[model samples]
Target: MDMKKDYDLLRERAELLKVLGHPVRLCIVRGLLNEGEKNVGDMQECLEIPQSTVSQHLAILKSAGIIDNSRQKTENYYHISSPLAKELIEVLFK
Candidate 1:
């Protein structure tokens, strides 16, 4: 691969990681990974966090493309977008 492409990919990955650096976002990611797909209410119940706070963190994760959402009826469900999240979380636990 070209060096330029590698550099660009690294930069993009760095930005994604930076966006996920917050504790709240990390928690949201972890919750999604563990629970498979979850709505804001599920995250709030599992994480014991306020709905607004969880939504805020989820917004960051969504903006960063680290997670994706789908609407089911009136609820939006969230899940990890990449396998990198699983790898990162495993490393964090090690």
Candidate 2:
């Protein structure tokens, strides 16, 4: 294994793990994987957290390229866009 050659990949994996390290964030991803796409309202309801808090976590997940959202009129529906994230969640649950 060449650390120098794979440094970028390692860094990206580290960042992903860091983003997922949060309990809320991990729960959010796991929910998406199990339930398919969801809006902020739906997530907030399920998480029992403030909508703002859910949005904040969503922003971090989005910025990290772990999730993506589609605007449907006024509501933005989010889904897991990263295959790595899905695999990680599956591994964790199993």
* Local accuracy by lDDT, each model: 0.84, 0.98
Candidate 1 lDDT, tens digit per residue, 9-79? Answer: 99988987798788888888877776689999988987898899889888888887789999999999998
- How far does residue 66 in candidate 2 sit from its true spot (Å)? 0.1
Q: Give candidates' CA RMSD values in order.
A: 1.9, 1.0
Evaluate model 1: give its lDDT: 0.84
Worst 10 residues of 2 by lDDT: 1-10
lDDT of 1 at 84: 81
**Best-performing candidate as measured by lDDT:** 2
lDDT of 2 by residue, 13-84 (tens): 999999999999999999999999999999999999999999999999999999999999999999999999
Give the count of colliding residue pairs in each prediction: 0, 0
Clashes of 1: 0
Those runs of model 2 whose alpha carbons end farther than 4 Å from true positions after fitting are none
Off by over 4 Å in 1: 1-3
